[model samples]
Target: PAGDGKVTTPTGVTASKVTSGAVVLNWQPSTLTTGDGPIAYKVWSNGQLVATSMGTSVAVSSLLPGQNYTFSVQGYSGTHASAQSAPVSTTTAAAPAQKPVRSAYFDQWGIYENAYYPKNVDTSGAAGKLDVIHYAFANIDPTKLTCFEAVKASDSANESNPNAGDGAGDAYADYQSDYNSGTSVDGSADTWEQPLKGNFNQLRQLKAKYPNLRFTISIGGWTYSKYFSDAAATDASRKTFVSSCIDMFLKGNLPTGVAGDASGGAASAAGIFDGVDIDWEYPGSAGGHTGNHYSPADKQNYTLLLKEFRTQLDALGAAQGKRYILSAALPSGQDKIAQLETDKIGAYLDYADVMSYDMHGSWDAKGPTNHQDPLHDSPADPTTPIAPGTRKYNVDTTLAAYTTGLPEYGIPGGFPANKIVLGIPFYWRGWTGVPAGSNYGLYQSATGPTAAKPLSQEAGLAAWKELNPPAAQTHWDPVTESSWFYDGTNFWTGDTPQAVQARGAYAKSKGLGGLFAFSLENDDASGTMLNSMDGSLR
Candidate 1:
């Protein structure tokens, strides 16, 4: 031991990221010649040794929030401890508001043809307080196996020139059209010459006004999920599909011809979206669209696909210097849930958007006139056969199934409760020509819709706008915590404001992530349903 032989101290110590109860400390490793061994680091915080690491950075957690702390790192060679590195002082952030996520699925098609544009949304109500907005649909090309196509819809109004299918491009509604209104989030009109225009541009402006709102492009819905099984059939195919999605949404790679014109070019819509959502209807079974490819292998491949998506998204996020989210819209039916490897697949997703509403609908061969989106089970009979369209199906059961019924492959049991987000319906499933009774034909045998409601254009289905029954006609089922209305011949069943509040409260209580409705456009212009959801969380 020589007089000038004091171990050289580490330097440049800093706490780069400080959260409520964690800090990531970084410091230059020590450079010294001591008789001991290899160099190691001892992270000291407030005079207490918190961690030991061989690397330059260490994450320290369980620290008190809203408190000042000084951190220093000491280099150790063998048994000799060098003088501590320069201390870095930092104050932890206050504990964040533990508010559950409140999300809404916005349908892009509703903007133009339905006359329910973004400008018509009541920002003061539920629409304004949303945490996440999932823009409905980016379809996978069944043939090309690359790119997400826009919502190409037909103009049913023009009989002579019904818009022909043109490669699924809907730029005019997405980010092209100018919807000038007093309720513009920025109180400004689109220049009409901007590269990006419609609801996308409107969404960008809205996000600027409300910085915390997150928007994700939801890929796949009932009508457009014909290619998911094939896309995820093999690792190579999955990678191809995933890369294509990232390029289209995250990298803003627009398709040539139709969609390309709207996107302007690559990366044009890059920053507009925070992530991509997979809405692969039913993975191992039939989804919303006909001719969907499916197989028993889909169960396993589904998990692999999700893992790949997570891997690619994480890589992209790392390269882009930001976090990206990966989520999925999952089926609510227990039978359908069993078909997929959900316990494993869910691990890669941010949350499982359980389509808890459509548990029962007119798609059934026949129905007992049950509510489509009940909050809880009403019939207590265990032996009662719970048909696809029966009263036994409820939101509570769906939530429980995702969080506890299925074991996570040695993860004790059941899906992680926190990763489950209860999905509520924003519309009603209607049945016509029902026999009127004391319960007004609820749970009674009836002939399903004789014809589709003209406005909704879907047989046995009606949106909130098309199926608003009188207040006196509505009835509440206490056991199930659901509401239904039967105007003698027409039986409509869906969520009421009270039922939505009940479900939201249930989600909060169960430690679930949050709630996401099937759609925002289905709510009233006053944002009544959205407000009801807001009030429940409050």
Candidate 2:
């Protein structure tokens, strides 16, 4: 031991884990210690001493955002100061202010089925106003083992739709259709040999015109969710599925089978999407066909799958210098909610879009008529004994479960309130054979399938655009924050501009991020529902 010799300086001083207001500094232990045995290290930043630590690392905090700073370390021995090691420099990330996400879901099949193509959208007054538009949907091709596929005929469920012929989605509509007229967002002709054409190109054009708009491809809806269980069964499978997804959507890897291979040079779809939105119908429950996979382990595996997606997305975002968003269309039913680790799942998501609608519909043959998207439960008799399982599951209860019940399932205090988006429906559910009453058949017993309306022409369903229910019969329920109408034999339940306004107000008051609807095309051609939503949110 060189007792009188000077102590060696700490080597390899470096800064890691740099954040908005903090930087962690680490250095190799000193080579030569004071005669008193081991030595402490002095961490300095910008020539000013910050901290002295017995260990190799020290965390310095309270730094200003977007400020550049350099750090170095020195080995200390008694009263002697060793020379400072090499300095490491870094700039703190600018802390971004949280903005509310006013988002909506767009259906791709709407182009042909409803004749509501991107061109039909009121870009100046409607689509352009939304912050996020989730395109529905992309499915896992069970045959191809790829998550990307052309929107197929079966994917088109518009049997009564006059605009839809054969019900097969047009790939040409996706990227290479010559609309020549109403399709252009700016009344400009399509650019030949463009990196993308058709609706995808139209969307790109729309985004170009409205730079604030962001788009996400929602994968695995009710019709196409059969493969999610298999895709996320394990880490390797999840990687394969996610890789195929990014390649197809984010990377602009066009399917030759449908759109014909066309890459618009280096700028393909490479950055078209700001993120991926998973619309896996029911992860651990049997909401899908009996052939679909269901298991108790799905609750745990679903969380794991989300973790993998977040890991992969974050890695890609880090490389691309953008933060990719992750979101899910969650089940509104408490039974379906049971399969999710609500508290843990939110950690991986940008937001949770709760499908608060479809709580009751014509699908239930002998069901009690109720508000399909009530903000709160129907007032039940407090004294009357009611089974906890039979409790009315409303929007408030769903929000409470995620924000409150998660603790019982292990996550204390559930998910963040601001990360939840209430989902509403833009269509009405109809039921027939209900006993005539003062409430206009609402919350009453009913048989199935009412006669088709003159507009929607569908027996049991009617889009808001086609729903011209007599204004005199329409009634609003303040308690549930919903609306209903019954004309003698037919009972109708759905959201109106007033109901949507009320829901938006409730969401804002509760600190929720925003509200979303199943399909934008369902709204009136004049943009009635969207205008109401925008007005309420503002």
RMSD of 2: 15.9
Expressed as tens digits, the lDDT of each residue in 1-538 for candidate 1 is 1113445677898877787655677777776664544555666665555444434665554455687778788776544567887789998888787677788888888864466665555353654688778888777776776655555663332323312222465666766566565535456655543344567656655544444566788887765566778888888999999998887776655553454443344334545567778888778785444456788898888889889989998886654334577888888766677676646776798887888887666665256677777676665423254444332456765665566663422122257888888887888987777887657777766676636766577777777766776899998888778888888888888888888888888888889888888788787767777888877877
At residue 87, what lDDT does model 2 achieve?
Answer: 83
TM-score of 2: 0.75
Determine which window of 10 residues in candidate 1 has minimal summed lDDT: 157-166
Q: Considering only N, C-alpha and C atoms within 3 Å, which residue pairs clash in candidate 1?
A: 175-197, 175-198, 176-197, 176-198, 406-414, 407-414
The reply for model 2, stretches above 4 Å from the true place, is: 1-97, 155-170, 191-195, 257-267, 380-390, 406-413, 452-458
Q: What is the lDDT of residue 200 in candidate 1?
A: 69
RMSD of each: 13.5, 15.9
Q: Give the true-structure RMSD of model 1.
A: 13.5
* Cα lDDT computed for each candidate against the true fold: 0.69, 0.69
lDDT of 2: 0.69
